[model samples]
Target: MRHHIVHAGWLTAALAVLGGVFALYVHPDFLVTLVDQIWSCF
Candidate 1:
């Protein structure tokens, strides 16, 4: 039972982080800037 709780907590945190990142991509301006920065690395 304790192990299951710990796993759930980690899963929830991962999902939250992914949700936040997805929210950021919803903006065209942010997406463009992110792509520009990544492309610059090459």
Candidate 2:
């Protein structure tokens, strides 16, 4: 159980960093457009 908790925490931290980097490097408009495209397809 402890191992699982640690793993989840690390994964969450890594994803947060990845999201920050993506937001900083990519344009917000592009991300919004991609999300819109995917959502419309669904």
**Best model number under lDDT:** 1
lDDT (C-alpha, whole model) for all candidates? 0.93, 0.89
**Alpha-carbon runs more than 4 Å astray in model 1:** 28-42
The residue-by-residue lDDT of candidate 1 on 6-42, one tens digit each, is 9999999999999988888787798889899999999
Which pairs clash in the backbone of model 1? none
Give, for candidate 1, the lowest lDDT window spanning 10 residues: 23-32
RMSD of each: 2.1, 4.7
RMSD of 1: 2.1
Identify the leading candidate in terms of TM-score: 1
Rate residue 39 of model 2 by lDDT.
Answer: 100
> Cα deviation of 28 in candidate 1 (Å)?
4.6
Estimate the TM-score of every prediction: 0.64, 0.60
Please state the error at residue 41 of candidate 1 in Å. Answer: 22
Model 1: how far residue 2 lies from native, Å: 0.3
Clash numbers, per candidate: 0, 0
Indicate the worst ten consecutive residues by lDDT in candidate 2. Answer: 24-33
